[model samples]
Target: MADEIKNTENQELDWDSPISKDAGEFEIPPIGEYTFTVANLEKTMSKSGNKMADLTISLDVNGQAYVRHDYLVLTSNMAWKLASFFECIGLKEKGQELTHMPWDKVPGARGRCKIIHEDYNGRPTVRIDRYLPLTGSAPAQATAATAPANDMPFEV
Candidate 1:
C-alpha cells in the first residue's frame, strides 16, 4: 500500500497591498577576486541538444549573498571553461584531460574567482572573469611552479 498526496486549495495572493520595492533591489559587488563555493551543478541539454553543465557559485561579501552562473558546454571549443573549473576546484591539472571524470562530486567545492561587471543592454550584470584555486591547494602550487615560460594569450 502507498500513501497518496492530497491536493489542497490554492490561496490567493494580495496584490493590492503595498510592497516594498527596496527589498528586492540588490547592488552588484565591486569587480575583484572573491572566495566562492560551488552551491550546485545542474546538468542539462543545450538548445542544440549538446550537453551543458551549469554551475552556480555562491559568494558571501560583507554578509550579503551573491550568485554567479557559469555555463560549460562539453565541446572541444568550450571545454577549457570546464577544465578551468576543475583546476579552480583543485581537481585537475593544466593540459590534462579527464574525459571520464566524475562530475557529480563538484558541489561544495571552494575556490576564488575573478568577477567583472559588464553592462548588457543597459543593465548591469556580473560575469566570472576567471577561476583560481585556493592557496595551499595542489592546483595552485602546480600553477605557481610550472607557469609557462612564455606568456601565451588565450581566452576562456
Candidate 2:
C-alpha cells in the first residue's frame, strides 16, 4: 500500500520494480557526549505499566547524523533520569522544583547527551547514557564542567 512504505520521495512505488538491497546495516557511533535535538515526544505507558514519555532524539556526531530513542519513565526509581533530561532540555535548572511538566515545550529543544554501546537481546545497540547541560546555557549555580556527579536536574 502507498501508505505502508516510508518513501523519502513520497511517490507510489512500482509493485513489480526490483528492490535495492544495497542498504547497509546501521553503524553504532562511538561512546561519548553529543548534541541532540528533540525530534518527537509521545506520552505513553512503559512495559511495566508506568507512565512514560518516549523521546525521539536526533544526534549529531562530528557532522554525521544519528537517531536514538530514550524514555522517561515516571517512577521514583527513574526520577534522577527524568530530572537530568528536564535540565538538559532547559526545562528546569539544577536543584529547582516544578509542579508540572510543560511537555509541549520539549519538541525542538536542544541539549547534550552521552551515548554508549551495549548489548540488548544479544544484538549490539546504542543508547543515551545520560543527559548533560546544554552548552553555553549552564545553570546559574554551576557550569556543566563543575556540576557534581550526583546533581539532580529537576525541581524536587
Candidate 3:
C-alpha cells in the first residue's frame, strides 16, 4: 500500500504577510572559479530523451550562498563530461578512465569548477563552464609542477 498524500489546494496562503523580496531571487554568479558541494542527485530524462543525472550544487560567492543545477546527459559523445563529474566529486582521479559511476557517493561531495554566464533562450543565465581540480588535490599540484618554466627563452 502507498502512503496517502495530503491535498493542499484548498488551503489558503498568507499572502497578506510580509515576505523578503530576495527570498526566491536567483542571481547570476560572476564568471569565475568556485568550490561547490553536491546537495542532491536525481536520475531523470533530458528533453532529448537521453538518460540524465540532475545535480543540485551549493556554492558560496562573496559570502553569499547560492544553489545551481547541472545536468549530466548520458550519451557516447557526453562521456567526457560524465568523467569530469566523477573526477570533480572524487569518485575517480583525473585522467583515469571509468566504466561505472557510483552515483550514491556524489551527495555531500565537494569540488571546484568554473562558472560562466551565457545567453540562453534570449535570457542571460549562468552555467558550469568546466570542472576543475580541487585547489589542494594531487591533480592541481601536478598541473602546477608541469607548468612551463617562467624563465623560458620564449613565450609558451
Candidate 4:
C-alpha cells in the first residue's frame, strides 16, 4: 500500500510540465514623455531608518498599461523632489511653501512625466525621469534627472 501511495504522489508531480506554456515576454515601452496619475502612495522606513515616501504612478501609453515608482526621502535636500512633484500637478507653485498636507492626499494627482528605459543589473527597468507641469498644452519633455550611481539601501 505504501508503494502504491508513493507512485500516486509521483504521478501527481509533473517535472516536465510548464506552469504557463503560452506566457510571452513583456515589452518595455519606449522612453518618452507620457501622462501619468498618482495611483498610490505609501510612507515607509528606509534601510537606514530614514523616513521615505513611495509613489506609484500609472502610465497609459496608447492603451498599453505601465507603472513607474519613485521614492522621496524625507530630508531637507531631498524634499525638493517632493515639492516639485506637487508643483507638477498644480498643487503648489514654484517657491511656494508646503503646508501641513497629509500624505493620503497625493493620489489622484495627474501630470506629465518622462519615462526612461534603463538597465538595472542586466535587466530592463522603467524609471521616471521627471515630472512636468500640467498646462493647457502639453509642455516639452522634461530633462531626465541623473539617478544615483549606487543602489538605494532599501527595497520597495
Question: Using alpha carbons, what is the TM-score of model 3?
Answer: 0.70
Clashing pairs in 1: none
Q: How high is the lDDT of residue 123 in model 2?
A: 66
What are the per-residue Cα lDDT tens digits for candidate 3 across 50-99? 99999887766766656788899999999888888778767787777776
What lDDT score goes with residue 42 in model 3?
93
Task: Quote the RMSD, in angstroms, for model 2.
Answer: 13.2
Error of 2 at 120 (Å): 2.2
Select the stronger candidate by lDDT from 2 and 3.
Answer: 2
Which structure among the candidates has the greatest TM-score?
Answer: 2
The number of clashing residue pairs in each candidate reads 0, 2, 0, 0
Report the Cα lDDT for residue 144, model 2. Answer: 29
lDDT of 4 by residue, 83-152 (tens): 7787777677777687854576578767888888777767777778788766774333334377786767
| Ten contiguous residues minimizing lDDT sum, candidate 2 | 1-10
Where is the poorest 10-residue window by lDDT in model 4? 1-10
Residues 46-113 of candidate 2 have per-residue lDDT tens digits of 99999999988878777766777888999989988988898898887788896688888888788889
TM-score of each: 0.69, 0.74, 0.70, 0.68
- Per-candidate local distance difference test: 0.70, 0.76, 0.72, 0.69
Instruction: Tell me the alpha-carbon RMSD of every candidate.
Output: 16.8, 13.2, 16.3, 17.1
Model 2 clashing residue pairs (backbone):
96-155, 97-155
Superposed Cα deviation of residue 55, candidate 1 (Å): 1.1
